[model samples]
Target chain A: MKAVGFKKHLMLEEEESLFNFEQAIPEATGHDLLIKIEAIAVNPIDVSVRLNGTETYETPKVLGWDACGIVVAAGSEVSLFEEDDLVFYAGAFDRPGSNAEYQLVDERLVGHAPHGIDIAEIAAMPLTSLTAWESLFEKMRLELEEPSLNQDKTILIINGAGGVGSIATQLAHLAGLHVIATASRPETIAWTKGHGADQTINHRRSMPKQLHELGYENVDYILGLNDIDGHWKEIAEMIKPNGRIVSITRNEQPLDLGLLKSKSAEFMWEWMYTKSYYQLPEMITQHEILEKIAALLEQGRIKSTANQIIDGINAETLKAAHALIETNSSIGKIVLCK
Target chain B: MKAVGFKKHLMLEEEESLFNFEQAIPEATGHDLLIKIEAIAVNPIDVSVRLNGTETYETPKVLGWDACGIVVAAGSEVSLFEEDDLVFYAGAFDRPGSNAEYQLVDERLVGHAPHGIDIAEIAAMPLTSLTAWESLFEKMRLELEEPSLNQDKTILIINGAGGVGSIATQLAHLAGLHVIATASRPETIAWTKGHGADQTINHRRSMPKQLHELGYENVDYILGLNDIDGHWKEIAEMIKPNGRIVSITRNEQPLDLGLLKSKSAEFMWEWMYTKSYYQLPEMITQHEILEKIAALLEQGRIKSTANQIIDGINAETLKAAHALIETNSSIGKIVLCK
Candidate 1:
């Protein structure tokens, strides 16, 4: 099988940073499904794994998480997927990822791909959709069934034009929460509002003032997609009493959780790959969430965050996608299709 | 009206640490009730307030929370209690405290005193009970009615013999959870066991090894009644994936919240005074919780945590109680009654 991977940490411009390699196609075992990769998306995790981790690797580490693919074979223990079934998943962190001709994913982490969407679009949905869905419904404890109760509540999404933030804004809006999303550029601000943000605040400016101008005294929830340490103080001040804050961004410095003590507020971290990496009991719920997200996308209730789609699933195309994501100014998602 | 208060921060032995003062007996206004204070409990918060904080107030600050008294009068807007009703409460932090001969408290923060408990015993309950109830039910999201579902779960209560921990262990036990409490001393261990801990581990020892030896690997919930910074690493290691941690103790330094990222765990602060201090919409819930707790005590389902009773609610007695709490070795609660 042909794969895009790296043996050492290097900049994306380096030819060896990501190169074509040949490896034997792995056979499915236990709950694993051998899937023929059709499309893959570029996320910050993919870049981080490729560049930031230990450089001493015995084998080239294939790094990609979001994928739309078809199962070519299934292990004896697999029950959710079968050969030829189309699927979408954010595969586990410890395993070989989806930047390959064939990848093995646990059936519990795979979801049926939306019937009508293109492979690239479906590929872009899984990682961010799972993150956005779980961050809102599970971590933030938002009740989608009771939109009326959420009508008075508001959520502020930092870096709202990004992959996870785009989906989070949509989900928060669908839950009937007033959405205040942070986007510095005009295009990004317009993009966030198009995806369901009721109001937009510039992350580069004073967010609290902008939120106040939009008539929200404080938000009931805050979903931080970028620069958690930078936005910590503002989030602490902008969260209502007993409010919730969930962040996907890593903080460079320690956070003063004491600031939230007076409000009796909660702080949670939403790592989408947590269940799969930890093999937690709730790993099967990822399959359920992805299926629901696929349904919503098919029904047009939610839109795919796939902003830039590059043709071909080769090392060259993967490197291009990675380079675009490295800029950090890319609005939504970058995808590479077969 | 006689009151014990301080205008300056000073040592307990200093004449001004807690001094005698006189003021008019405040009239009940709106939801307020004029209570003839019979007893008051000195909590760690009282000691912290006296010693910590940068500002010295122009007016003498009366520092007390837990109180047991008779309602001498009720405002026109008060409907929950009448004149002469025996009530117990942890009144609002922004108001004049219960360390006075007569005090005005919002009816919503007051509860009917248990029928069989002494004034000192009842006074010991309000603050700790509210903190425990909120930490377990509201913050940890434990369901009290559904014991069957709760039976499989376990909760680790840090500092199990403290005022809040003593009550929380019983509540968690009554909710059907296996309660693993942390007690450093033999007397505290016995006290926690008597309060309903299924097992006890010394917080000073390896809690993780102790839990594993007791046939458990991780806990589903952790109520941190003591130091968060000291036990953070162990707590992070012992919490099951997606577990909840609620802390009442304040951390002097920043916390490494990133440690819980891969597990997607939650951390919440359980400040019982948040509702009243913030004037949150859910302030009424505190009243409801106290009333229910009062009923539970009346039915003998739980008991007051009062460990030592001082002779009177005067400066000398309050100073003595404060000094005892400052040592950080008090078993349950310290009450100063008139």
Candidate 2:
């Protein structure tokens, strides 16, 4: 099987930063499904994993999470998927990722690809959609089914034009929340507003002041997608009493949790990989969430977030995607396809 | 009206620490209830307020939260109670407290006193019961009515024989959760067991090791009532993936919140005064909770946690109660009555 991988953590300009490699296709076992990769999406995590470490790997480390694929084989114990089924997933964190011709993924993490969608669209939906779905519905515990109850509630999404943010804005809007999203650039602000944000604020300025100008004293929830330490103070100040805040970013410094004591606010981390990493009993909920996302996509209720699609799934194409993500100005997502 | 108050923050032994003073009885206004005090309880907050500040008031500052009294008057906007109604409450933090012959409280923060219970019993309950109930059902979001769903879940309560802990243990048990409480002494252990702990661990030792020895690697919920900084690491290690933890104690040092990131665990602050302090719209829920608590007490589903009672509601009795609380070894609660 042909794969794109890197043996050393190096800058994108380096010749060996990412290169073509060959490996034997792994066999399906346990609840695994052998997926033949068709399309892949690149995220900020891929760029971080590529350039942030110093250790050289014994084997080239494949770095991709979101993929659209077709099952080639199923494990003996698998019941959810079988050979020739079309699927999409954000693969597990500890295992070999989807930047390869052949990969093995748990059946519980795989979802049926939405019918009639482009491969790049299907590829871009899994990782960000699952993250957005879980952060809004599960971690923040919002009532998606009771939109009437949620109509009066509000949510502030920090970094509204980013990959996960784009999808989260749509989901939060679909759930009937008054969505306030932060975007610094005019294009990004327009992009976010197009994707369901009812209002946009500039993250480069004081978010609390911006929110106040828009007439909200505090929001019912906040989904933090970037620069957690930098925006934490504003988030704490802008959350209503008994509000919830969920973040996917790691803080460089310890947070002053005492700021939230009087408000009795809640803090939660949404890794998205937590279930698979811990082998939690509810790991199959990933499949359920992706299925719902697929239905929404197929019905055209939520549009795809793939802003840029490259021509091929190879070292050069992946390197270009990573380079784009490192610039931190890309709207929505960038995908690489066969 | 005669009240127990202090002009300066002083040691309990000081003559001026808590002295008898005279003041005009306050009239009720807008949701306020003017209550004639009968019994009062002392907590660690009273001692901290007495000895941890340097500010002196022109008029003596009164500091008592837990009280059982008879309502002498009601404000124009008050709908919950009327004149001569027996009530119990943990008054708002910013208001003049219950250490007086007459005090004013918001009707939303007051509960109808349980029938047939001792005045001291009812006085010991309001502060600790409200804290315990809000921590479990509101902050941790545990379902109290669904015992069948909660029967298999487990909750670990640290410092289980303290005022809040004793009530939390009883509430968790009544909700059908398997309760694991921590106590350091034989008397405290016995008290916790009597209050409804299914098992007991020594918090003076390593809580994780004690839990492991008792055959639980993790708990579904944790209610931290003691030193959070000292017990944070253990609590992080002993919480199940996606579990919820609520804490009342303020951490002296910044916590490494990154520890719970991978498990997707939730951290909540449960200040019993949050509703009143923030004047949240849900403030009336305190009245609803206490009404339910009154019914539970009337039916003997849960017992009062008062362990020691003093004779009178004067300065000397309040000083004695404060001294006992400062010892930190007194089991359950201490109340003073006229």
Candidate 3:
């Protein structure tokens, strides 16, 4: 199968950074499902894993997490998916990712793709949806099924225009929380508000003052989507006593947790890769969440966040997508389709 | 009413460290409950409030939390208790404490005292019981009533022979988790095991190595009762993926939260005073918890953690008790009674 990857981590500008190659199609065994890639999505994790490496790979490492594909074969233990079943998934962190034509993904991680949406749109939803779902419901323990119970609750999504933030703002709003999301630019602010943010604050400005002007002393929960270390103090200040704070952003600096001690606050990290990286039993929940997200999309309760869909799944197309991601101003998801 | 307090924070040996003074008894209003002289329990917080200060108090600051006494009066808003009701409570942090002949506490923070327990025994329970309960069930989100569901879980309680630890060990045991508590001394080890610790590990040594030898890779939950800064690395290493860690022990230095990032772990602060300190509506949950604790005591499902009962709730007795706390070797709780 033809794939795009690199033998060594390098900058996108380099000649050997990402190049097309051919490899034998891997077999489906145990819980694995051999998938023929249909469309792929770009996320910050893809950029991080591509650049933040020192070791050289014996074989080129195919790098892509979010994808919607058709299963070509199923393993002996595969029960969730079958041959020719259209599926969506955020592939495991350690595995050869979805950039390849024939990729092997565990059946537990695959979910039935929504037939109502295009392949690129279905590909865009999995990674961000799973992250947003787990951040609010699993890590923060919000009651998603009982939206009425969350009527008085409030949540602040730190970066509301990004891939995960766009979805999180919508899900949190759907959960009946008074959503306060942050976006610096005019277009991004409108984008966040369109996605169900009740109020939008600028990440570049003083968020606490803006939050105060909106008549909330503190929010019941905080979902940190960008620059967690930079926003730590504000997050600590803006969280209500006994509030839960979940962050998917990686902190480059130290965070003072003592600020939350008197408030008895809860801090949870919702790394989407945790379940797959650890091979935890709850990995199957990703499939369940994707199924729910697909239903929500099909019902028109939520729309796909795929903003920029490029033609072709080749090395050149993925490189252009990665460059757009590097700009950090792109709203929602960027996907590549063939 | 006579109260033991100090105008300025000082060492225990100082003449002005603690002194007796008479003041007019306070009136019960709002949610206040006026409790007459009975018994007061000494905790580490008392020592902290007494010594960790620099400014001279206008009115000598009274310091005590746990108490069991007859409610001499009840406020207009008090529905949980009536006048002359015997109650146990851990009073709010900002209010005048229980180191007095009479103390006024919010009724929501007070619970009906168990008739089966001695006054000093009941006094020793409030602060410690509340801390342990909040740490285990509320902060850590452990299902206490449904113990069978927790059969596969394990908990590591750091400092298992101290006031809060003694109760926490029992509570975690009742919750059906395999309790591994830390105790270095032979007597402390025996005391921890007696309180239902399934295994005793030495905190002075490498906990993860010891844990490995005991047929466990990592604990599902960790209750950090002592030296959070000291055990932080090990706590980070020893917590299983998606584990919850609750700490009452304040970290003097900054703690790196990034260590738990890949595992997506949760860190919660279990400050028992948060609800009352913030005047949150859920302060009444403290009353409900204490009521449950009293029933547990009455049923012999749990026991009082009081180890020493000093006669007289006076300046001298409090000073002596505070001195014992400063030693950091005294196991269980120390109480003063009239």
Candidate 4:
């Protein structure tokens, strides 16, 4: 099988940063499914994993998360999938990724792809949608209802034009929350607004003041997609008593949790790989969430967040996608198709 | 009305630490209920309010949270109670406390006292029980069912012989979780066992090793009554992936929240006063919880955790109770009764 991989962390401009290589197609066993990769999406995580490390690997590391594929074979223990079934998934962190012709994945983490969606669009929906869905519904425990209790409650999405934030804003709106999303640029601001943000605040300015001007003294929830340390003070100040905060961002410094103590707020981290990494009993929840996402997409309740598409699944195209994501200015997801 | 209060932050041994002062009785208004206090419980917060301050106040600040009393008057909007109702409550943090002969509290934060329990026992329950109940049921969001899905789950209660822990261990036990409680002293260890702790680990020791010795590597839930800053690293290390941690203890230092990212764990602060303090729409939940607590007490499903009692609700008695709490050596709760 042909795969896109890197033996060392290097600048994207370097020809060796990502290269085409031949690897054996792994066998499916113990609930694993052999998937033929059709389309893949590039996220900031792929860029960070590629560039943030300094040491060279003993073997090439294939780095991709979101993939739209078809199951070519299934393990004896796999009950959920079989040959020729279309699937989409954000694969596990410890395994060889889907930036390849074929990959092996746990059937429990794979979901049937939404019918009638383009390959690039279907590929873009898995990773970010899983993250946003789990963060809002599972981790933050937002209750969905006909007349949701979240109608009066507000949610502040930092960096609302980012991949997860784009989907989060839409899902939060569907959940009946008043959404205030942060976007510093004109195009991004308009993009977030289009994604169901009731209002937009600039992350470059004081979020609390912007929220105050928007008439919310404090938000009932905060979903941080950018830097958590940078926005820690603002999040603390803007969270209501007993509010929930879930972040996918990394904090370089220690967080002053005392800021949320008086309000008795909760803080949760949403790493999409946790269930897969831990082999948790709820790993199949990913399958459930993705199935729901597929329904939402097919029903037009949510549209694919794929903003840019590049041809081919080889090294050169992946390098270009990584370069775009590295800029951190991309409005939505970047998809690469074979 | 005579109140036991202090104008300055002083050691409990000081004569002026808790002095008798005369003040005009406050009238009930809005949702307020004027109650004649018959019993008061000394919690860690009372000691905190007395000792952790800088400048003296213009007037003495009364510091007591839990109380059992008779309602002498009700505000026009107070529909929950009327004159002559026997109630128990942990009043708001921003208002005058229960150390006075007459105190005003919101009717929503008060519960009808258990019919047959003594005032001292009832007073010892409200604050600690509320903290425990909220942390377990609300913060950790544990489902209530016997032989629950929690049967295979484990919980670690740090400082498991204190007021909240004594009740929390019993509650967690009743919820069908395997309880690993921390206690340093022999008496506390015995007390924790008596309260339904399945296993006891010393928080002063390497908690992870102790857990490993007991055939467990990580816990499914953790309830921290000890210092959060002190046990943070241990708690983070021993918490299973996607676990929940709820703490009633305040961390005086900044916390490294990044530790829980990979595991995607949850951290929540449990301040019993948050609902009433914010006048949140869910403030009535406290009244509902207390009513349940009273029923649980009546059914013998839970027991009062009052460990020591002072003879009178006066300055000297309050000073003794405060002194015991300040030492941090007291077991269970200390109450001062008329």
User: Pick by DockQ: which candidate is best?
Assistant: 3
| Alpha-carbon TM-score of each model against the true structure | 0.98, 0.98, 0.99, 0.98
Model 4 DockQ reads 0.90
Positional deviation of B332 in candidate 3, in angstroms?
Answer: 0.5
Interface root-mean-square deviation, each candidate: 0.6, 0.6, 0.5, 0.6
DockQ of prediction 1: 0.91
Tens-place lDDT per residue, model 2, B87-141, is 9999898888999999999999999999999988999999899999999998887
Error of 1 at B156 (Å): 1.0
Q: Give residue A253's error in model 1 in angstroms.
A: 0.5
lDDT of 1 by residue, A109-172 (tens): 9999989888888999899999998999998889876899899888999999999998988889
Candidate 2, superposed: residue stretches over 4 Å from native: none
For model 4, how does the per-residue alpha-carbon lDDT over A136-185 read when each residue is reduced to its tens digit? 99988887544368888889999999999999999999889989999999
At residue A122, candidate 3 shows an lDDT of 89
RMSD of each: 1.2, 1.2, 0.9, 1.3
Q: What stretches of model 3 exceed 4 Å from their correct place?
A: none
What proportion of the real contacts between chains A and B does each prediction keep?
A: 0.90, 0.84, 0.91, 0.94
Cα displacement (Å) at residue B245, model 3:
0.3
User: How would you encode candidate 4's per-residue C-alpha lDDT over B77-148 as one tens digit per residue?
Assistant: 999987899999998999889999999999889999998888889999999989999999999988656556
lDDT of 3 by residue, A36-95 (tens): 999999999888888987989989999999999899998899888778899999979999
Q: Determine the backbone clash count of candidate 4.
A: 0
For candidate 2, the chain B TM-score comes to: 0.98
- The clash number for model 1 is 0
The Cα error of candidate 1 at residue A212, in Å, is: 2.2
